[model samples]
Target: MRRVLALLLLLALPALAADRPPRSGLDYATPGVRAMQADDFANPGMLWVQEGLALWDRPGGMGGTSCASCHGRIEGFAGIAYPRRDPRDPDKLMNLETRIEKCRLDNMGAPPYGYESRELVALTAAVRHQARGRPVAVVEDADAIAAGEKEFRQRRGALDLACAQCHEANAGKKLRDETISEGQTNGFPAYRLRWQGVGSLHRRFQVCNQAVAAEPYPLGSQEYIALEWYLAKRGAGLLVETPAVRQ
Candidate 1:
């Protein structure tokens, strides 16, 4: 019965999308939470932003260099085109965090930040803050985009569900005590009441995978990275809401 319902939902996607285009999860936030995200002064996430800014100028381990020493304070929406396919390695897509880590290991002689680390999260929040209101500008490579779309729509795991079954077909429908969300990615590196700290989009993906009893991919894995690009593309026109507060 459940699988039948999922099939029906899959068939209904075109009508569902046309009838009501997806919305960011922010639309599902409580009034209080929404206001928290709206007001930077009131948002706790700013602490990380500040931390990241401090790190940006501090001398790194090697050659006494800093991010600003090279990048010299990105003056515009520089990172908007991130997670891009590496020119030398077209199959590998590199996001801001990966680039940062590469600089640390190769240039600064520093260790990579562990997943969800305070320093890493803060830095990502700060960099993304530079493009707060700009839309995501990732270039869609054909192969990644196609595989990502397939992954987004395929069924798996104990529940036998696809991402589209909830985030696309039954978005806004009730699921237990919470309303289903479109699961958009514009407001990533967000603060969640459940986590009591900022988290990355990949972390959220892990959480969702656990919920469905599906095996979650490792952080920075090609599969999840492709999905991140796909989801970001889905929110092409929505503002990048870094350090966004969520519940």
Candidate 2:
């Protein structure tokens, strides 16, 4: 009987150890992340910023008129106050990138770039550059807020983990070498050293879902767009850092 009890205790020890939560560390929030929030304008990624600026002024596709021709100086147009509920379509909200595509199609008389395209990336970076100092303030009208919150809390994936499980509950905890952040969207279109390219929040989400063994949703899918709207609102006070910012 004594031998059996000891064997049972030994068998349960590994399970107990596996249940322990991850640890937190300063390394999780990299210096690049801090620099991005403090002063992204001075970051080396601003070279893309210049390219985006030029792209904004250049004509493309069937549209002879540049974004500059209609919107005038992009420097005066800020993009931080976005992800707002569209008055015409209350069921849908518009993020800065979405609004830019709409303007490109309607006002600039050009074909809209596909989501994650270089043209869209450049244009978004250029437009976001104008809002360098502005604090992010995505709208949180009742319906939009409710929908966003639902997406944030819902779990989907083979791992059975929701974004909230890591970003909200275990935020600051370490999973291997990387520390988890609050999953803020302030430093978007950021150049992650790991990725070797500038990418959008949606791209990051896809990577994260894959890491947890979740099926990745298509780019520009309604689910991702909704998630973007939610994340933008969640990081309302953070500043916009565009282009390929080093992570």
Candidate 3:
């Protein structure tokens, strides 16, 4: 009887391990957190939103024209669809944030905001706020989707892990303490307690890449942007809840 019991315990070990969920300090599924998931209109991140609004109207660079001079009232364009193919660059599509930066250079004749800069954060927050209450609707162009899918499946870093392994394959499996989510990006510029700061989806990707020991890409790089395109499309039908989220 003892010998039989030992064998049974050994057999169950793998099953128990497989059932465990990945652990993280973040509590994405808490009821309070879920309730705030789609509340961007009165977001606590509105401080950043205000900063972005100011930047939009402030004159800068040698051209001496503000973003408002060209784009008009930012509020008027709220909830407008994005991730459209760049008319100039057919190979790349422009997200709302990217378009705003491009306008800063082309129309406002100002330098692009640095990634992680207050200006960028404010701008992204502002643009995202405009989409408040609207379902995320990224384009599904074949080329863009294919590129994103390829990145999603590629194994990289010392961990030799692909995003799909955890998010798709082992979702809900415990690594230590917390449940794993689908690695969604519907809530961005989120105030992650872990990060202790606000960040964009691309920044999150960089952190994940580093965690797995992969080479980190520069922020706003074409590769990261392509990945964002893929992720945004994957998160389509979800609402945009920016600046106010906690992960």
Candidate 4:
């Protein structure tokens, strides 16, 4: 009975293709989620941004210097060219989260935050928030982008689903109560009602992979970073939506 009800609910959802015409995951969101994101006061994700700013000013590391001391305000720093080819090691890719970890250990002489750690999420949110309204640029690394594109196209795991299956071909189609999307990353570090918390893009990526019965990669892995880079490129011209709310 429960399974039948669930199936009915999925089918009952309206066929909605591309929720908002102008673009944005916001267009696809439920009314409650859209309203939550519209109001800064009500958006629970703001708490994490607030926490991120706090951590920015707090002193850490063996030498005791805050992130603010080095970079000042974090605004205008996120431009969506992340998962860049690492300067020290061209083979390695660095996303906002991984870059933060690197800075903590190398520049600040501080311990790196654990993956998906509160501190890491806060910092990443704060950084992305700075980039709000900025356009995502094309990646310079040809090889990496090519590799990511290949991954995006290939079917994987038990479901044999590719990232493009829904995001590219079936985007805007109804999936149960929600609509499939072009899979933009502009609104990352977003507040998800399901999570009841702010989560990184990689976190959401993991969820998608699991949903498809694919073996998900570890957070911050090269695979994820590559995928993020490609996704960012695909989402070029979209505004960053850090701390945005999602259903």
Candidate 5:
């Protein structure tokens, strides 16, 4: 069965963790991409940010309340290292996308903006943009961090490669035409040339899972929240680059 084959492939891969501290994907980006990210006008991700800002003011939900009604100006919001334990429900982990959805459902009386939807990505990016240079800092949850670290190391998909293999062990090395980076999460919702649009960290996870022929968990799934929590911890000191451009 495919499961047996995948396990066998996983067993065959090497187990080496990069000893260096975490590095942002920005370091590996091409000059053009870096330039694009640097310039507000040039960054296509800003388009989503614009949309999100407008949406923040527009009335929504059954009550016809806008996000501004409660949260005020989006620019004043501080950056967060999310996928943390939700304050309202300590048992649950909520990322920015989930937080936005929760507000829409519970506060605004609006329908949830499904994961990877343009509106969700825009709002997430807009909020994150406010915290552009802040470092990733969140209260640690040992259980979730450990679970995520395990997920990061485990090999999946038909290729049987673990995330550590490329992002940790072989970072900065060439993988065909492109260089491999240390797979940091400080940047999202980011603009990828391949995607040709802004997308969330979970969207990136799905793409990575699909790349190796593994089944991807649902966006905002607990598994991903845990993985994202681990990644935020791993990239603790890195500054947020919400609209980062990546190859």
Candidate 6:
């Protein structure tokens, strides 16, 4: 019965999407949370933004150079295009965090900030915050996009739910007192009230997997990175809203 229902839900996706186009998760935020997100001072995620700017200028490691040494300050930086196909390794897609890690290790002679660390998340948020208002731009990578879409629709976990069932099919509906969102990634690296701090898109993905009783993938894994790209593509043209506050 459950499987049949899931199949029916899958079949209904076209109609659902046609009726309601994709929208940011912010649309589902409460009035107070929405206000908090709009105000730079009120948003807790700004703390990470500040930290990231500081990290850019703060000298460190054997090279004794800050991120600003190469990329300049965060103030006038353009929006970052990530999950890009690596030039040297075409098969590998490099997300913002991985690129940061590589820069630290190769360019700065510093140890890479492990995934989800405070410093890394702060820097990622800070960079993204600079790109606020610019549309999300992703290069055409057919294979990765297809893989990501498959993952989005694939039912997993003990509950046997796919990401689309909630984020796509029931985006505006309430579930357990919380409104289901489109699971867009534009406002990622944002502050979540539940976390009381900023977090990355991949971290949220892990949380969702766990919520469904599935073993979550490791941070920075190819699977999650591909999904990140797919979400960006799905929400293409949406302005970057890094450090956005979410309930």
Say which candidate scores most in TM-score. 6
Across residues 93-190, which tens digit of lDDT does each residue of candidate 2 receive?
67767787877786766788877887677677677767765676576676666676787777888898888778866677787887777677766766
Which digits, one per residue and each the tens of the lDDT, describe model 3 over residues 42-72? 3457677788889878888566888777678
Which 10-residue window in model 1 sums to the lowest lDDT? 74-83
All-Cα superposition RMSD per candidate:
3.4, 7.7, 6.9, 7.8, 5.7, 3.3
What is the C-alpha local distance difference test score of candidate 1?
A: 0.81
lDDT computed for candidate 3: 0.72
Q: Each model's number of backbone clashes?
A: 0, 1, 10, 1, 0, 0
lDDT of 6 at 176: 93
Q: Give the Cα lDDT of each candidate.
A: 0.81, 0.69, 0.72, 0.83, 0.87, 0.88
lDDT of 4 by residue, 1-247 (tens): 9999988876554233223332578877778888888888998998999999899888997768989889876764765567787899999988989998999899999999877988889888988887877776566777787778787877988989998778876777998878987788889989889998989988998999998999899999998888888877767678887888987
Clashing pairs in 2: 191-245
Model 3 Cα shift for residue 211 (angstroms): 1.4
Global CA lDDT of candidate 4, please?
0.83
Off by over 4 Å in 2: 1-28, 32-44, 61-63, 243-246
lDDT of 6 by residue, 1-247 (tens): 9999999997886676846555777889899999999998998999999998888898886768888887776776655588888888889988999999988998899999888999999999998888888887787888998888888988999989999888887788999989988899999898999999999999999999999988898999999999998888888767888888887
Off by over 4 Å in 6: 1-12, 15-20
The TM-score that candidate 3 achieves is 0.80
Candidate 1 lDDT, 156-195, residue by residue in tens: 7799888888888788888998878889988888888899
**CA RMSD (A), model 2:** 7.7
TM-score of each: 0.90, 0.78, 0.80, 0.88, 0.90, 0.92
